[model samples]
Target: MAPTQYSQPERFRIALGPLLYYWPHATVLSFYAGIADSPVDRVYLGETVCTRRHEMRFAHWIEIAQMLREAGKQVVLSTPVLVESDTDIAVMRKICTQGDFLVEANDLGAVRCMERRPFIGGPHLNVYHADTLAWLAELGAVGCTVPVEMDGPTMLALSAARPAGVAVEAMVWGRMPLAFSARCFTARHFRLRKDACEFRCEGYPDGLVASTGEGQAFFTLNGIQTQSATCLDLCAEVSAMADGGIDYMRVSPHASGTGEAIAHLDEIRRAQRPASPSPVMPADATPSNGYWSGRPGIGWVAEEAGT
Candidate 1:
């Protein structure tokens, strides 16, 4: 007998990545509760960024995972990106060892500890080449997210070249997560150092918007992270993505109306609905889909409702 080649079932699936900001504990719980009743196929639950944002602890994540599982949804735990100390690595070990659902390995450290259980290769893991995908497969990577900067054609090529049994995912929605940093940009903006930042990043429900020379919102200085000012919107390109071999589309979390966001994605994935131009208008937040165009992630391309 030979190994089976990977095959997608010819349908799109929406996955909700872990909430990136530092929201209140109650907000986190109620958020997942809303997702439990939504139509997203898989939901990633865990902190993928700074370790200081302890509002959602390991146990809380596990509890949420169990709740999502019980609600008939697939769950994956995402590990943090920058592991500055042994304590963070220890937490990573705990998450990998839990063995409840798929663990999304955001860095090589997490991959090293994920013993044989099929895990997801988060975008933080530089997965540009087919060989990288192959290497991760050897370590039991079941699915992997392509970096946000890669254009559609480049992503299509990668999808075609993926190793056997591996699925390729992309962050089609939300502000483009450009890079992570050792210093906290948000804290500095509020006149505080990293150690005593007082969770100021939480204040920006989206992110601290930074603009260009013309005072236009260009990017955001998040806590040890940099994100595009405009949320990456791919509402118009979901069909084209389905045409490509991309398997899953990830919608990163914001502060409010995440359930509605997940539901809209489910509509497109199921083909039970048509593509809409504006995403959940007047919902206290807006969307941008220009990253899929391969231009500057913030650049917007206006399309008629169903172009």
Candidate 2:
């Protein structure tokens, strides 16, 4: 195993990614209110999935950002991944123009729009190469969230010679975002049209799980995003990542146990060791870190004892 980097605790920040799944207004507000006191150093706000979700408007997101900022957490507003209409473009423009906090650019158009302003390159941006990362840095990107599919060695390779002042972040826990489409999958699951989804996704705070033919949990369906049914657990790999130049570990929000997850990661960072294999998962749960080891995304590679 590699040695841990960063002699200072402030160098490695923990981030809470934007809520990918839609929850009611009260639930969303309440989630962040509690998160305001979490051990996290950053909080990403805004709807990154379906644009039709109005439970929290731009103003509401701004309010949440301000609240988190006041609590001493760095706040970044994330843009939606699959922007479709003129309205989407308008909203993206509005977010980029906020000028108060950093914006996480989900679309290439967002990258083009945010030129000359420091921004966050979201995981959805497909930033796979050092050159691309450097280009984004040249465009004023100060940090980037590495895609879930990018493995440790690849991450090391990218970070080894990455542009100066550009920080690297990786998803350390939660359902891995696999893909996004123009179609509304959760609405389709309930036999509803995209235009009239009736907000079916609201019923599933985490996401609707789609299983295999053998009844094994497989994929998670959000409005338009397909995520891994099995939550990705890289808790055991945090030390290695820290050693490899990762500056941040992001915990994707779930309807339950988010705080506990953040607390556990903080504990691991402080102790600089592997956490006891995460609270026993469900029978159908398939926790994985193979992608981090350069294998198939769903496969788990166990660590040898006392590395």
Candidate 3:
């Protein structure tokens, strides 16, 4: 009832996506603790990246969602894109059965199962354009996370065709979640079996960065998923995204501090005229915004000197 601070009087929104890696339950709790007090309007909680990364279960996820709700944040449970087992479906069913919180279906199976339930169809679902969005909206998809590879113009065009009150979101900061695989890259790299790998991924706060043979930091090996090593900074590009009809902007949680990332995105959503400093590119990541420009996703063009 606080007038929905995010884009209420403005034109854009900021949201926190589901944790993409397997973090300890305590770390997850603490991260949301800070987010609940931050400037973000919507917060999504659930494990959608890997089914094996389990420090928290259905009960725990529900608890965390409750906590975020108590702190005045909207909560959503995200289903796995590649559900490989009965247990995976079971857990996803539990999340779907929660009924109260909104659900973000990441895969086709989830979409099919969530018939007429008014959920958020996640980016991993690969919805692009008016027909796809219209189809999803018909299935009770109230919102859809714009795929990371989509450019501002395309997203804007898609928004112009979506259903009424249906929202579009963009990833504004943090490691870009590029792809997911069935094999645990970290465990395999360490010469271990997927089931008995001791969950080595939990030790990495930001997931392991993998470079290409040409010495380029191409992606991150996070358990069974591969993420771009570079943090996607849509800060300078926010205006274009907003104009493109993006309703919600997303910031994925890195190991260090998620609050700052969320706050920075909040500033952009509020359309503050003054600019902010960009992320310091680490050796492993040459940050780029080319995806917003409609080129290759990794291709980034420098912003105007003042922008």
Candidate 4:
């Protein structure tokens, strides 16, 4: 029998991605506890970067996951983007063994470790074409996140040709993750080795910013991952996403204003009106949707009167 073709939802679901910055254990726990009442449909857990900064242990993550699940939200454990050490591999293996909750495979190694358990293709995974999406689906990926660099036209094409049973998710709001490396940029900035550096990332509730020589904020350093200095606010693009057949919109958690951001997006989804004129940003963050509009990643082209 032929496979069932993928179907688009009338409205996109809001998913809360795993926390990227290191925060105090209590703060991390409290944040999710409050998220249980938020309008988010799915919540991703586990440390996705810099395992050295262990504010929440494996058990703590599981506990929070259970709490969110009980609150009627689907929970998915996210593996780190760069799996370098044996310890990282071990944790990835353990998370894959979690039968109750699904896993999001950020690294290709984690994809192999999942062993046919249906997983979500994390943003770190390179999924640029229909065949790549099909291959991942053959390996049991039920959903896949589009890379932040992929523009709307490209995404529209992929969404049209994606294999049956696979869904495409986009990062609708938050700082775009630009790149990941083995060296810890956060520790390096303090002139310390990655292993020996004190947990300084916890000091910045959100990741620290890196400004250019001319003093323009260019990127955010979250341990080893580099993120766009400007947050990608697609709050105004819900109708565009729905028209393109996008299945889900992943909202990366911020240090503050996450609930308000999700609420605004929820309002847009429920109303099904034209895109909003303004974009919202959390405290100390700027807005940009240039990449989605097929321009440079940092440019913020304002919407026209009717666009």
In terms of TM-score, which candidate is strongest?
Answer: 4
Clashes per candidate, residues 3 or more apart or on different chains: 4, 0, 3, 0
lDDT of each: 0.79, 0.84, 0.77, 0.84
lDDT of 2 by residue, 1-307 (tens): 9854423344367899999988999999899999998999989998888888889999999899899899999999999888899878988889988899999999888888887799999999988999999989999899999999998889888878789999999998888999998899999999999999999999888899998999887899999999999888887676667778999989999887678778877777776435433553323456777788778887777761112
Model 4 over residues 1-307: C-alpha lDDT tens digits? Answer: 9732222233788889999989998898889989999989989999988777777888899999999999999999999888899878878888888788999999899899888779999988979999999999999999999998888889989999998889889887888898999999999999989998798888888889999999998999988989999888776675677778887888899887788788776766776444463345756788887887789988776761124
> How well does each candidate superpose onto the true structure, as a TM-score?
0.90, 0.93, 0.91, 0.94
- Which ranking of candidates, highest lDDT first? 2, 4, 1, 3
| Candidate 1 stretches greater than 4 Å from native | 1-10, 281-287, 303-307
Instruction: State each model's C-alpha RMSD to the native.
Output: 5.3, 2.7, 4.2, 5.0
Per-residue error at 208 for model 3, in Å? Answer: 0.5
Which parts of model 4 have CA positions greater than 4 angstroms off? 1-10, 277-279, 304-307
Candidate 2 Cα deviation (angstroms), residue 18: 0.6
Model 3 score (lDDT)? 0.77
Question: Candidate 2, overall lDDT?
Answer: 0.84
Model 1's lDDT to the true fold? 0.79
Candidate 1: 10-residue stretch with minimal lDDT: 277-286
Worst 10 residues of 3 by lDDT: 1-10
